[model samples]
Target: MSHRIVSKFGYYSLAGFAGSALVQLAVIWPQTWIAVVALGAIALLYFAFLLICIKGVLKGARWAGVLNFNVLGVDAIESTGIVLFFVVGGVWTCLQIL
Candidate 1:
């Protein structure tokens, strides 16, 4: 009972985090049309996953966890790449301008 409750909490958190990440990426890369279109496609696919999880959570589908874990993996990788580009890429850009 408690585990399901916690999983539900985590599920909502995942949705919120995904929303924030997608919005930030879109805003940050609006000038790049290819990136924007790619994001749109990814967002559509994620929405499908979200719908599936929401519908399956009560029925106890293991596939929900699998999909959630995969989404989080991608999120983690994306976040790490963002941090790298923001830090290292910024430094490199500064060095080049100097």
Candidate 2:
């Protein structure tokens, strides 16, 4: 409903999407045509949802607030997965550099 809420949602959604993508890529270790295609499809759908949320937020739709809240809840559940992914990936990257 409010612009502040919309902006917060947009920021969180973008962050969540990035985190999810990273985790997906790490888990799948894409190495084949099917894997690439599937990842691409998943990316497309993810972006679509993000776009819808953005549009709804910009338009100040009440439904957007509801959707944003739901997304936040989902993100919270995925937070653990994202955190683990980040921790492992960060350590791996650091070790490689060292």
Candidate 3:
């Protein structure tokens, strides 16, 4: 196993976080201050994880790999849940509006 793979994931996570923030801030435009603040906090947390991943990978630490997989698992679950909501529940999906 190579740390390169973890670094790659970190990069992808960074992109994803940036894209998600763009969508929330620009495209969706959250309706309330609370929502905006919450989103910002989440974005910060994601970036923190990315930094931790980079540090761990660079140091060849086992904890970094573990953290990476744990974060990946959580993301997979959230994505799968959203997709299932649309596909299985016949939900009408729409972007958030300000």
Scored against the true structure, residue 34 in model 2 reaches a CA lDDT of 57
Tell me the spans in candidate 3 whose CA falls farther than 4 Å from its real position: 1-31, 67-98
Winner on TM-score (1 vs 2): 2
Q: Write the per-residue lDDT of candidate 1 for residues 1-98, one digit (tens) a residue.
A: 68986775565555445545444554566665465356556655656665566677656677665653443365644543343333343334334443
Rank by lDDT (best first): 2, 1, 3
Each prediction's TM-score versus the true structure: 0.32, 0.39, 0.38
State model 2's lDDT.
0.55
Local accuracy of candidate 3 as per-residue lDDT tens digits, 1-98:
79986785565555455444544454445464465456556655656666677678778797776663543466755543333332222111113333
Of the pair 2 and 3, which is ahead by lDDT? 2
For candidate 3, the per-residue lDDT at 79 reads 49
Local distance difference test values of all predictions, in order? 0.52, 0.55, 0.51
After aligning candidate 3 to the native by TM-score, how far in Å is the CA of 5 from where it should be? 22
Query: In order, how many clashes per candidate?
Result: 0, 0, 0
Indicate the worst ten consecutive residues by lDDT in candidate 1.
85-94
Model 1 off-target regions past 4 Å? 1-31, 62-98
